[model samples]
Target: MFFFERAIAKQIKNGGGPYFRYIDDLFIVINWPVRHLLKQIERLNNFDENIKLKANIGSFTNFLHLYTENRDGTLFTAVYQKPSYEPYYLPSNSIPPLHMKKNIPFIMLLRTIRYCSTFQTYLSERENLRMASLLNKYPNKIIEQQFNNVLLKFNIDQPLTINNYNKYRQNVLDSPYKEPTGIDYDKVLFIHFTYCSSMEMFPLKFHTLWSKSFGESPINEITPVLRIRNVKNLQRRLTH
Candidate 1:
């Protein structure tokens, strides 16, 4: 066991009774982690056996609660950390239970990528392919298609030809215009092409997976407890 777990176990034995444990989130809101807590919970469950764990993480929403104490006459009630906007605490007049609020966007392809790095590692290639395909299929979708038209108007049709791809690339790279306009449009096309192609390579299948699971790929809903836990970890690191 980790030192924190051991220390918590010892604290439970010496001080407060059983504690609330969030296994997946790796958080325990107990003053002392009692070694026999699981056994105790099981015994309690026998009396009122309707409770079921919501996730691998232990929380009141999943199971029952028990009471514990502190050295300074504090009442340390042990309950799994229920998903909430605020920290879990006793229902004193000052602190009330905060129900969780969910807000996630669909098509947050960027956000979802952080969880599994497999997609991020190859994002550039994915985006490039997406852009290339998009440009090939939907010429109108290119932000700077007008540039090609302008070149054509100047009777410079060779630049856009497949055989003259390198020449076209060189003209765009060397062009002084850096924006999406008749004068300087390749910049816009290049950027759009890069991301569109990269995203294509990145995989729309993953987006479909997210959509299937959450009803939408762009907007999503995640465990609020997890979001809070992440914020708390960040705060701790910053403070430390």
Candidate 2:
């Protein structure tokens, strides 16, 4: 992927438009004629038999979960969900520990913030999430409080700044564990922590037992695990 991107970087830059790619997904903003764009696509496809380029040229398109519309000279974007999407969330009464339940709303809200580009979009998506919660038998007041808490923490105001909004998301989602600088790893002990209602002592004991069982490497070599919940797939159901 790196080599292919490098090979085409010059061509794309000289094409007189913006081009961005994430992994294998390519997004090109072009002002050229359709025929010219088609020719370019054809040329790209012919460049490598193993790599085939599938191109879609339009004023509106879906890319990486964002629905984008080129209106006049401006671009408008909103969250895009597949037609088969079915909203579902963790039920309030689930058997998991209390901490997991507490974390659920904040995580969901964080995702809502990341995906929705505008306040209206956020409200619409949030309402859909609330409806899902309702289906799961979560209390309306509790859900509202949780939503408000997230908004308060983020200081989110109307007419959102999409770019700046995402900056603090990682901090909200994951607590950092600094790895030691110098360490040799013979074996890696990975501790996966999820929300637990129990006191801090519970994790401490669990960590002890885990270390006893697997043995521990120096903290420096251990990579901190950051779990970011992705509800996109959970939102969809198979249409059978």
Candidate 3:
């Protein structure tokens, strides 16, 4: 992937438009004629037989899980879910640590805030999450509390408007403080754990073991971040 990207970087850069690449997905913002854009895409596709590219061009496009639309020269974005997306979340009745289960709502609410660029978009996504929570058997009051928690964390006291959304959205990214100054660490490791309904105690056990092994290390500190999976339905493949 690296070599192929390096080989085509110049062609893409010189093609005369702003382009961004995340892994194999490419997003290009162009104001040229459609004919010229197609020609450039064809040229990119022919760069390497092994490295084929699929291009979609329009005023609206889905990139990096956000639906971005250009309306009268202004850009609007909202969270995008594929057609096959399922609304499954960690079951509220699952046998997990109480805190983990309680955090489900907050984690999801944060995502809604982060992805929905407009106030209306945020409300729409929040409604969808509320419905999904109902299907998952989560209590309505719990969901409401979670919503309030997210609003408080973002310092949103009034009704969410486009201006407030933009302000607090940037604040979420800026809220985390930088690592304490003057602390030196030889190595840093970011460990991620996936949650499974069947293995409720796995994360707790893993953390306990990890602490016993590395708690006395010379590292200044260890921070744990819990990430909730956006996609809950797992597709299984059979191998012969």
Question: How well does each candidate superpose onto the true structure, as a TM-score?
Answer: 0.17, 0.57, 0.64
After superposition, the stretches of candidate 3 with alpha carbons farther than 4 Å from their true spots are 46-52, 158-240
- Overlapping backbone residue pairs in candidate 2 total 2
Candidate 3 lDDT tens digits, 82-174: 888899988787644557666888988788777777788888998998999889988999899888888897677865677677787778757
Highest TM-score, which number?
Answer: 3
Q: Model 1: per-residue lDDT, tens digit, 22-51?
A: 552222344323545565445533543443
**How do the residues 173-225 of candidate 2 rate in per-residue lDDT, one tens digit apiece?**
35355697753344444444554334335565765665676465555455333
Stronger candidate by TM-score (2 vs 3): 3
- Candidate 3 differs from the real structure by a C-alpha RMSD in angstroms, to one decimal, of 6.5
Ranking by lDDT: 3, 2, 1
Please give the lDDT score at residue 157 for candidate 2.
Answer: 46
Candidate 3 TM-score to native: 0.64
Best-fitting candidate, scored by lDDT = 3
Q: Which stretch of 10 consecutive residues in model 1 shows the poorest summed lDDT?
A: 100-109
| Clashes per candidate, residues 3 or more apart or on different chains | 24, 2, 0
lDDT against the true structure, per candidate, is 0.35, 0.65, 0.74
Task: Indicate whether candidate 1 or candidate 2 has the larger lDDT.
Answer: 2
